[model samples]
Target: MDHNIILFRLYIIIALCFLIPLSLLVSIQLYSLFKSYALTYFLLNFFLNNNKVNCNNKDYDTLFILLLKQQRFFLCISSVEYLLSLRYSELDPLYMLLAYCYQNHNFCYVAEYYYLKALSCSPNNEIILSKLTQVSSKLSKHPKLYTNDGLIL
Candidate 1:
């Protein structure tokens, strides 16, 4: 009976050794996911609020960097679009962000359009010019590859 109790205790210790690390890993993942979701929600609310004029470019830049780091291109595009709908319509950076998001999604034509818009906003911007040239060449190389909606066929 004493031997059986010792074996049971050993088994419990082994189980805990495995379970503790597993539980820690799972909790870490859950916490990371929760943080990501909370940040996304906050960003959505920040962009959607009507009183955006009170916010500055630094705040937008920080949010843009965060969205990019998270690889949330759709949210980045939507947020830039909302900003453009406001007084930032002529902002070259907003156009550039939109172009980049579309390019990442393989919408080369739409990307080219926004790149051109960005270039129009800042005619001397070498980066926008280079991106436009690249997208233009891509479109030329595969003229029939994308449908009217700019999705690859």
Candidate 2:
């Protein structure tokens, strides 16, 4: 009877350990989903607002430049999420921007992932394919580094 009680207690503890954490993970994921949806709309509005401003206006142009810079940072973070397969986060724009950064920075593996992600969304994107091809050529030339760690451009 003592053995049976101890075994039952251990089982309860194990079940709680897994079940509580799984529930928390699921809740966090759901929260992130909603947050991402909201961020998508906010980003869209930000871009739209910038576009509606007069291009010839110096103040508007300055603002636009700042916004663009911020957008690039956001894109980079998002790209990391994509590379890490953390789709729970919204990082598509960051991923696209990440491709450009990788291409220029000689991070071919990261560039490849970013390019692939962009292409996945717009399969026939000529720009993405061109970048991918360029990176691929660079990678082939330096075949000594074959791991994804080197894929980041």
Candidate 3:
């Protein structure tokens, strides 16, 4: 009985050690999602929810990056815009985000532009080059939103 109790206690300790961090991370992710969505709500309501916890640029950026990595382009847009407005005085766009958004929106040529711009920042990146090639190929193969006297062609 004593040996069983000792083993049970050890198992509980190990499980709690793992679960505590996992739960904390999950809660933080949930809060980040809620806070980001709150920005789209009424201004007063946004402020009310925002006042509960002040997240800095890094926190917002991390969440934004996570959303982008998840291929949640539309969701990340608000986060990117918020991060840009907060950190940059002139509000410079994140080229990667712009490329992802445009590509998702079916603006292949425009996405190619931003992807090229992003490639300039990371010249040797295979991912950026691959995305650029993909978008460029798409641009050449399909009718764009504007071409040939404002007609899709």
Candidate 4:
């Protein structure tokens, strides 16, 4: 076999093994994920109502939810893609936003999870600590029941 033919075979193998998986991962059905987020904010009106960020208030959380609910899958996907590209996984603000959404929806367990994630990113945060305490106290004896949404405690 010629050198070029060997290289071509290697390229094909690489493409099949790597590129295909990469594309599969990147081309996920984002709308479905957004819908199945188990939180509300997948509506156009959510973002349309608030664009301000008030950490002390629920505005930031609501704003993010609204942004996601706006049905702008490409925009949402790109924004998250940029964040991932920058390796920004443990951002407390992101966690806090999600936590608030869960809390607001009465998914206390999920909210607690995100609150802890936020605390890990930014320790000594009074808001998060306070939330953690509040949510912790509200945790039921059942370890898996979060809400009446059929989720296991």
Give the top-scoring candidate (lDDT): 1
Q: What are the root-mean-square deviations of the candidates from the true structure over C-alphas?
A: 7.6, 14.2, 10.8, 15.1
Model 1: pairs clashing at backbone N, Cα or C within 3 Å:
none
lDDT of each: 0.82, 0.62, 0.66, 0.63
> Order of all candidates by TM-score, from best down to worst?
1, 3, 4, 2
Candidate 4 matches the true fold with a TM-score of: 0.39
How do all the candidates rank in terms of lDDT, highest first? 1, 3, 4, 2
lDDT of 2 at 22: 100
Q: For residues 1-153, write the lDDT of model 1, one tens digit per residue.
A: 999999999999999999999999999999987887787778668667765556777778878887887899987888887777777735899999999889988899899989988888889998997788778787885334567789653
Question: For model 2, what is the C-alpha lDDT against the true structure?
Answer: 0.62
TM-scores, each model vs. reference: 0.69, 0.36, 0.43, 0.39
Error of 3 at 54 (Å): 12
Q: How would you encode candidate 2's per-residue C-alpha lDDT over 54-101 as one tens digit per residue?
A: 333343334333434545545544434433453323334445666766
lDDT of model 2 at position 140: 89
**Candidate 3: stretches off by over 4 Å:** 1-58, 65-75, 81-93, 141-153
Model 4, span 44-140: residue lDDT tens: 2343353432123254335455555655444543443344355554478766766666676688898899889889888989899878777887885
TM-score of 2: 0.36
Q: lDDT per residue, candidate 3, 47-138, as tens digits?
A: 33663335544554555555655577775666555545554432323767778887988988778887877787778877887787678777
Model 2 backbone overlap count: 12
- Between prediction 1 and prediction 2, the one with superior lDDT is 1
Specify the highest-TM-score model's number.
1
